[model samples]
Target: MDWDDMRVFLALARVASLGRAGQVLKMDPATVGRRVSRLEGHLGRRLFHRSHQGYALTEDGLRLLPHVEAAQAHLSAAETPNDTGAGLSGQIRLGAPDGCANYLLPQVIARICADHPALEVQIVALPRLFNLSRREADMAISVSAPQAGRLHVQKITDYHLHFAAAASYLDRHPPIRQIADLRGHSLIGYIPDMIFDKELDYLANLDLHAARMTSNSVPVQLNLLRQGTGLGVVHDFALPHAQDLRRVLVPVFSLTRAFHLVRHADDLRNARLRRFAEALIVGLRDQVARLEQAVAQADDQANSENP
Candidate 1:
């Protein structure tokens, strides 16, 4: 099968729509469709079932995907490395969730800009998921665990989150001495699935049926919290660097979500990509201690207020 065809198929599989796949590839939707059809014809089997929601993989497509992915990885690794500057000098496309960008990336971005002035870096804020295989982005910062794939991936940090409320709201509402007490209060939340499973997964431990408001934008949700709409589960990194909010007395279980730095296996060999990745890793490590300190201070203040 044509390697380009396989790539298109993989993009379609990941995106679940010809339009979205085309957007990532910078190709016309018809061209993406033609390429997928050609691949199916070459294989002499129906690979996808077209549906209103999007294409669903047929049994044949599911069976062929693993082999296709392996072949692509093997072929990609065989290329001779190019002479990229021992340092970096080209644009590195980075994608990140807004919450992560707001809380975690400012220092990293500043250092990268200072160190590699020639490198034109572009950061795309992706509140929704981005497709890496389609080259939609060169690197991604996400809270989710990396999936099984041919990716150069590493966990940069484990971020913690806990439920918190405005001091005024806590005073007006009934006391929350236990997780069960949260049921009576209005709740604010991130767009349910966009939040990494681990971060909110234990909400199952809480008895609330649903959030009063759900937003992908942390700033918007935080604003609502300031209005005393409800308590919210917010990342330690994203919480305000002030004492306006207080942690309720519920058992604060630490929810650890992995912050992953990922690049396509092929992109990993590009010297610029490698250098930026290293810089990001180093820059983030340096600030992690400071962030933990800030969180500890917040906890201390919160304890004082609640008691």
Candidate 2:
């Protein structure tokens, strides 16, 4: 019945390892084990199926999770009376695709850190799904909108990508005035089968056979492009950093995808999380003009050619 015991229970359930939970809670492993045992005793039921592999939540534990999370959210809301989020301070783990993590987030996070000196932001730049239900990340910027889950989703921005090649590479290769010219060029792209998210299947709609050189990491692909390895789809936002890269095929070969901001529904009431979400939304909105400029460059090129 103690909130402190429930906190221990939540921590253990999240990590599935007493040592890890203790690390998170800043308690000794033995103390964490004792607290879990006490909570189990008070409830008159085994919450975790203990094994060498680690703790697995029982059905009762799973059932209790939602209620506990709700209580935690309400408690957090109660403690932070200033809903404006100016006084918010806590760690926020954000999972984002490599491109956003590397190029987009640094400035946004830097500003957030300056605004709230007490807040810490951790960026996980993996190209895969972030499991919000399991608390893998407090929030995520995803390539695709989640179809179904206990999640809150918002469209962060619509960003564009175009087939690009290093100016040096283009100088050596046959001129590419059209999409068909790409066939004669060495293409750099994602390894088809290794793409975890359907949204990342950039080559699928291109009708291209396969890449001459491929990498799963977007940054790696960009590096390959920078090295003049071949033509590859590059994000518009990334162009600011890679000035040597030239947009090829003009307006004819381009892709636009939406970035979504997602978080667990239960954490919606937590002031710190809410504040970060607001900051993200505002920051991304402010970059809309710059984000769209890459696509506009292609249009300019096309118009010049036609004229």
User: Cα deviation of 281 in candidate 1 (Å)?
Assistant: 1.5
Q: Which pairs clash in model 2? A: none
lDDT of residue 285 for candidate 1: 66
Question: Per-residue CA lDDT of candidate 1, range 65-88, in tens?
Answer: 656656755554453255434545
Cα deviation of 210, candidate 2, in Å: 0.8
lDDT (10s digit) by residue, model 2, range 118-174: 877889899888987666678899988998988999998888888888889988977
lDDT of 2: 0.83
Residue 153, model 2: Cα distance from true site in angstroms: 0.8
Which candidate number has the best lDDT?
A: 2
How accurate locally is residue 93 in candidate 1, as Cα lDDT from 0 to 100?
Answer: 70
Question: Stretches of candidate 2 above 4 Å error?
Answer: 13-24, 44-60, 81-84, 291-307
Model 1, position 214, has a per-residue lDDT of 81
